[model samples]
Target: MLIGDVARRSGVSTRMLRHYDALGLVRPTGRTVGGYREYSAEDVRRIFHVESLRSLGLSLKQIARALEDPAFTPSELVSDLIRWTEDRLEREQELLGRLRTVDASAPTGWQDVLRIVELLQGLASTSAARRQQAVLAQAEGVPVPAELLAGAVLSESDPNVAGALRWALARAGGDGVAALTAGLRSEELDVRRRAVGALARMPEAPGAAAALADALGDPDPTVRRHAALALGGRGVTAAVPTLVAMVVEGSHDVDAAEVLGTLSQDPDTEDRITTALADELAAPTADSATRIRLTQALVELPGTTAQEVLRRLAHDEDRAVALVASAFLGLIREQPPEDGHDERP
Candidate 1:
């Protein structure tokens, strides 16, 4: 076959076939009387081979080495190609994500697109200060898309930058709840913690609330505690068990107690919260320190049941716990009763 016929059949352009010949990658096996390049059957087969390697992302140089070098090993070269392809795929995925984020921002013009790109770059910057500035700049009327803030909130490690990102998400309202919710399911413990934290700061929306409710069962105690506090403050009685656990574990016990107290203000949940605390106190595993913390937590609650629990603790076997409980009872007695219900007997 002549070079034209070879090009036509192989789909390799004639110019490219000539370049391959110049590079000795694939040379014509013969020549016609007019001195035009002519390809034998074997030469055309080599041409097909070169095109096949090119399809595998092999550079012309690599293809040359692969086809001509007797000492060349394909294992290492194939492995390298795999790594290179993976890297290319990762970069393309990141670019695609950025483009999606920009499109989701619904930019009105080129300026909006530029600003969104700049902000995204800043968020991904290595400097925590730059990331923080990017987040704070949203307050200047840039109107950052909530999903962008949600993404930043999940990945941010620096405390200050993370706080700023959470704040941005909160101010953006509940739009980012779905993204943050996805973060809750991340295998990374830190990402799940950040997701719940950001969700805690979000407005009292059903999606945010539902996500928090789901987070209450997180394997990490920190995640569960944060979710419990946030949900407790929102009057979600579902957080009662975790909040009570926080009291027993002495993890953020004070905040947990305050939220429990607030939750107990609801007549329906008041007995449930008080009983949970009372049961922990009566648990055989309740050590002196745990008992004392539980006693202090009981003081945050209203109604006669908590007062009755405190009264029982006033005479406890542990001298320190007894004294602490006694002190709390004295304070409770000095205070007036709630809602005209007198406990002044």
Candidate 2:
């Protein structure tokens, strides 16, 4: 079929199809005389597989390599993936811990974070070693080389960290990931997390996503959270389904739901996130705090889908859940009860 037809049938975009082609991810089986792409049924299924893995956090290059080698073993991929996964989890845990502490009525300060941010901002403007050290001391416990630290906050380019990352990418290109990816995993857990954070700036790699996926299975909850965050940065829609599933299994439901929200750009993907949230509401599996958090996320969605789902949950035996759902229905529709109106027989 043509690109539009394939997009309608497969739920993948035409632009992505071309990207897959460039990466040898999904090449058309044949070409039309007019030079348009052509695909077979098998090609469509392959696209689904590509979509699934991309969702699972594999990169295009890794996807290409995996396709070339059919005997691919998950065990070999899982090991290195786990190492970096721990790093990511530890860092997100630190940030989350601080946030939770602040969120709780605990007397605390973001003064530390603000200080760190200010110091990094100072060093990041220009390359001055003495000034960088002064800033580093003030921002103690802040990762050194504030430039890279800055980029770790995002997956995009920053003048602060670009030079070193270029050298790292070059070294990885020449010596391969064994020397770079593998060694970084051995650093202190926080440093490792920062390294995974660095993956934000670099281009996607098949293994990086896979590694992030494996990290989702880490024994620690915080590690899994960071893994989810890292996956969001590099992953495609393929990560959506898994992310939805994770929402149910997550020990930290609020965090999981928030992570899923980031992937809700596409309708199909957004539907999945909403559906998962609905499923949780319907089941009453989440605690009160979790349900509240989930409901807030539902309200934040772009449509009435979540509200509709809550109405369905009104059938539940748990009066609290049903009552909550009913209350949500009233709020979502932006109405209040009428005095003796008798709207319902």
Candidate 3:
């Protein structure tokens, strides 16, 4: 086969075949009457082999060694190719993600695109300060896409940057809820925690409450606690059990108690919240410290049941718990009853 026939058959262009010949990668072993380059069957086969290796991201120099060097083993080279391809793929994926994010923002012009790209780069910067600055810039009229903020918030490890990202997401309104909701299902514990935390800050965001409610059942105790607290503050009674557990476990017990207090303000949840606390206090597993925390939590609740629970606790077995409960009971008595219900014991 001549060069043109070889190029046509092998899909390697004639110019590329000539370049290969120049580089001594694949030299045709025959000549025609006009002294034009001619390829033997084996030469054509070698051309196909070179093209095959090229498709695997091998440079021409590496291809030359692969084809001609008898001492060259492919195992290490193939491994290297695999790693290189993986790296390239990762870069391409990141670029594709950035492009998608920019597109989602619906930039009005080249300047908007440039600004969005710069902001994205800032968010992805290794420096936490840069990431924070990027997040804060959104508040200055950058019009950052919510999904971008949601993505940044999920991966941010820096507490300061994470807070800024959450604030930006909240400012962006409910649009970021979907991305944060998807983050709730992430297998990574930190991601789930971050997602719940961001969602917690956006209580008024549509679907944010439901996402937090779902997080209440998360396997991670931190995630569940955050979710429970957020939902409790939103007056979601579903957080009652977790809030009671928080008091019993002494994990964010004070904050949990406060939310429970707020939740109990509603007449419908007052009994349920107070009952959950009283039951935890009565549990045999309740230690002195746990009992004390529970007593303090009960003080945050309104209604006669909580007051009665506190009065009973004032004479409990644990001296420390009894002291705390007695003090709370005195305060409860001095205060007026809530909503015309007599809290006096």
Candidate 4:
């Protein structure tokens, strides 16, 4: 077969075949009557082999080594090809994601497109400062796609940057909730914590409260604690037990106690919160320190029930518990004469 016939038969262009010949990749073995290059059957087979290797992302030089070098073991070369292909695939996937984010933004013009790209790049930057700046910029009207913020907030490790990202996500509202919900289901505990944290910031977003409520049962105590605090702030009485548990565990227990106080303002839930605290106080699991924390948490409750609980605990068997409760009750007694009446009177 002549070069033209081989090219036509193999789908390799004649110009490419000539280039392959120049590169000594697949030289035709004979000459036609016109002195043009001619290909024997074996040469045609080698041409097919080169094209086959090329299809696997082999460079021309690498293909030459693969085809001609007896010392070139395919194991290492194939491994390298796999790595290269994976790298290319990862790049393509990243590009596709960026394009999707841009498309989702529905950019009005090139300026909007550029701003979104720049902000997206910043969110992915190695520097926490840059990521934080990107979030703040988006908050100030950078038109960043909400999904991009959702994705960033999940993986952000820097406390400051993650806070900024969560703030931006809250401002972005309902659009980012799906991404955050996906984060809540992540296998990594840190990721789940971050997801719940961001979702907690957007309590008013559709399903945000529900997502946090679900997170209340997360195996990670930190995740559950955050969910409980957020839910408590949102007046979800279901979080009372977890909030009381937070006070016992001393995990951001102060914040948890404050949120519990807020939840207790509702007459319906005040008894529930105080009851859970009293139960935890009486449980055998409550060590001296646990009892102390629970007693302090009671100080946050109102409507005289907490004061009555303190009066009862003030005479408890544990001296430290009695002292703490007595001290709190003392502070309550010292504040005299509200609305022209004193509790002592």
Candidate 5:
């Protein structure tokens, strides 16, 4: 293609083409005998790339280096572009947040411009405030006051919504219990589990124990697990006998044991877990991960049982168990001069 055609196709002016040639930014293929520049198809491609970088807010000098660098791989250049975009976005968000603050304080005449500026500012922000705003908005079921929720993060909520629900369940009386019972009959397992567990937490919930027993028949493992746990947490003696039976024969033996163990301060769960672990260890085969988990759980228990097991596992023939036990023991020990027990065999 000729220089005129290249300029027309690339949208670069003729003067800029000459300047690019001078700067070695983009050059023509060759010159005719009359000395007029001629650009081949490759020249047109180069002009569009330079134009794209300029659109990204890259300086002419930076774009020149990027275009000229021989060692720059496509992936490396793309990664650099991503980092540049993220940095630009962060700066933009900070400006937007400031603009939001400014907008709330602006006089009537400046309000329209401030709104436009705030809208534009997010192009640079991290979008963190937007996430916080959405979460707060969800919690309130309405728009959260930006001034009060400013800089509030996702960590400020969630993970605790269910916990607060439990508190409500703990205090609700007859009518609340009835509503929760109806929730379990609803098709949604999430609604069922959340309501049931909260209902079971209250000491005086009407038929809560019966509702929970029915939930134990629910196909969902989570609903069964939470129901059993809530009953255990409340130490409702009515469920302990059933839990003891499950500890012996149910597929959810471990889940039941775990709930019981957590409720150990109020009920006798450790003995049941100990017996189950002993039975599992007696079997010719057990999943190694399960054994590992059981070992760690036992080690966490205080008193003679934990200490004796720690001593046994500390020198076990299995390399993984021995290494873990040795590492744990080393943390609370003092080196015995040059001959401490840490010495290699």
Candidate 6:
């Protein structure tokens, strides 16, 4: 086949074929009567081979080396192609995500588009200070979209930046909640924790509250504690058991106790709160230290039931638990009964 015939048959442009010949890659095996380049069947096959390699993301030079150099093993070249493809794919995916975030923002003009892009870039910045400033700029009336803030919140490792992201999301209102909910379902433990933490700080809208309620069942203890504490403060008695468990485990037990105390203001939940603490205290598996923390938590609960439980714990078998419970009971007794109701009603 002549160069024109080869171009027509193989879909390789004639100009590209000439470039291939000039580069000494797939030169024709013969010349026609008019001195036009003519390709033998073997040369045509080599041309197809070159195109095949190019399709696999091989540089033309790499393709020439692979075809000409007997020692040029394909293993290393293939690995390099894979790495390059992966890097390109990652860049494309990141660009697509940015575009989607911008589209979600529904920017009205180039200025709005630029502001959103800059905020998105800032949120993804290496410096925590920059990320925090991006979030705070929203407070200063920058139009950072809620979806971007939610994404930042989920991925932010720095505590301060994460807090600012959550604050910005809260102000952004319900738009961030959907992204946060998706983060809650992420298999990554840290992402789930961050999602729950952000949701916990948000206003107790039905969506956020529901997401946090689901997070109460998260496998991570940090996630569960954050969710449970937030729910408890919102008067969700479902968090009472987890809050009591927190006291037993001595993980954020003080904050857990305070939320529990706040939940106990309702007459219906006060007994349940007392019972949860009593059960943890009486559990056979609870060690001395666990029992002591549980005793301290009981002090946060009001009502005669907690007092009665504390009175029994004050003379318990463990010396440390007994001494702590006795001290707590003494303080409860010394404080006027009216003081308890004064704080509640």
Q: Please give the CA lDDT of all the candidate structures.
A: 0.89, 0.57, 0.89, 0.87, 0.57, 0.86
Candidate 3 lDDT by residue in tens digits, 1-345: 899899889988999999999999999998999999999999988888888898888899999998778999999999998998899999999999999989988988998898888898898799999989877775366677899889889999999999888888888889999999999999999999999999999888889988998898888999999989888888888998998898888899999999999998887799988888888888898899999999999888877778888888888888999999999888877776657776465
Cα RMSD for candidate 2? 27.1
TM-score of each: 0.95, 0.38, 0.92, 0.89, 0.37, 0.85
Instruction: Tell me the TM-score of model 6.
Output: 0.85
- Per-residue lDDT of candidate 4, residues 301-322 (tens digit): 8757877889999999999999
Q: What is the per-residue lDDT of model 1 for residues 1-345, given as tens digits with 9 covering 90 to 100? A: 888999889999999999999999999988999999999999989988999999999999999998989999989999999999999999999999999989988889999999899899899899999999987876466677898889888999999999988887877777889999999999999999999999888739549988899998889999999899998998888999999998899899999999999988876688898888888888999999999999999999877788888888899999998999999998887887667676675
Using lDDT as the measure, name the better of candidate 2 and candidate 3: 3
Best by TM-score: 1
- Ranking according to lDDT, highest score first: 1, 3, 4, 6, 5, 2
Model 3 CA lDDT for position 198:
93
lDDT of 5 by residue, 1-345 (tens): 677877787888988888888988888889988888988777788888889988876767777888888775557666777898999899898777666655643435665454434433432245546433333233232222233121221112333444543443343244355556667776876677666656556635667777787776777766666666667666654455445445444446566555555644432455554545545544556455444555554443333444456567677666676677666556434434345465322
After superposition on all C-alphas, the RMSD of every candidate to the true structure, in Å, is: 1.7, 27.1, 2.2, 2.7, 19.2, 3.6
Q: Considering summed lDDT, which 10 consecutive residues are worst modelled in model 4?
A: 137-146
Deviation in Å, model 3, residue 208 alpha carbon: 2.1
Clashes of each: 0, 7, 0, 0, 5, 0
Q: Candidate 5 — worst ten consecutive residues by lDDT sum?
A: 148-157
- Model 2: residues with Cα > 4 Å off, grouped in runs: 1-180, 183-194, 197-214, 217-219, 233-235, 241-259, 281-289, 335-345
After best superposition, candidate 4 residue 96: deviation in angstroms? Answer: 1.8
- Looking at model 1, residue 301 earns an lDDT score of 87
lDDT of 2: 0.57
Model 2 residue pairs with clashes: 55-238, 55-239, 57-209, 59-206, 87-193, 89-223, 155-200
Candidate 3's displacement at residue 139, Å, is 5.7
Stretches off by above 4 angstroms in model 5 are 1-171, 185-188, 200-206, 236-269, 281-285, 300-311, 323-345
Candidate 5: clashing pairs of residues: 89-124, 92-124, 92-125, 93-124, 93-125
